[model samples]
Target: MSELKLNAIDFISFAVAGNTFKLKANLIGPNDQFHSVNLDIAPDEIKNKTIGEIEKLALQALRSA
Candidate 1:
């Protein structure tokens, strides 16, 4: 098995959303904040993502705060 280095995530910033704190991203997608996760996958088992898929998911996840 192998580990895949996905994308880099940056903490954009936090804001006061009403009585709670909220975050924002510097790029595309829903801009939701999620805890970091490391997945274990075989080299061949890793999905070959297309440019659009990378953009839609990887970049989106990376840009998310």
Candidate 2:
């Protein structure tokens, strides 16, 4: 098997709830495994974060999906 790594994140949807945001995404991993993840984060945490940073956070959530 190939090494596990984050390949891509297809952000399918998003919505705001209270002080946080819920992002629905398809986390693409090694070997084309797709994991659906609902990542909830405070806007303050990612408002200034780069796309790469946000993707990293989403990928982390995918691990527990």
TM-score of each: 0.24, 0.58
TM-score of 2: 0.58
Please report how far candidate 2 places residue 23 from its true position, in Å. 0.5
lDDT tens readout by residue for model 1, 1-65: 01223344344233334332222212322344333422222333234634344334444454352
lDDT for predicted candidate 2 compared with the true structure: 0.60
In terms of lDDT, the poorest run of 10 residues in model 2 is: 1-10
lDDT of 2 by residue, 1-65 (tens): 12334445455344544667666655565657766667777767757867677667766775554
Model 1 residue 52 lDDT score:
42
Provide the overall lDDT of each model, using Cα atoms, as 2-decimal numbers.
0.34, 0.60
> Residue-pair clashes per candidate, as listed?
0, 0
Top model by TM-score, which number?
2
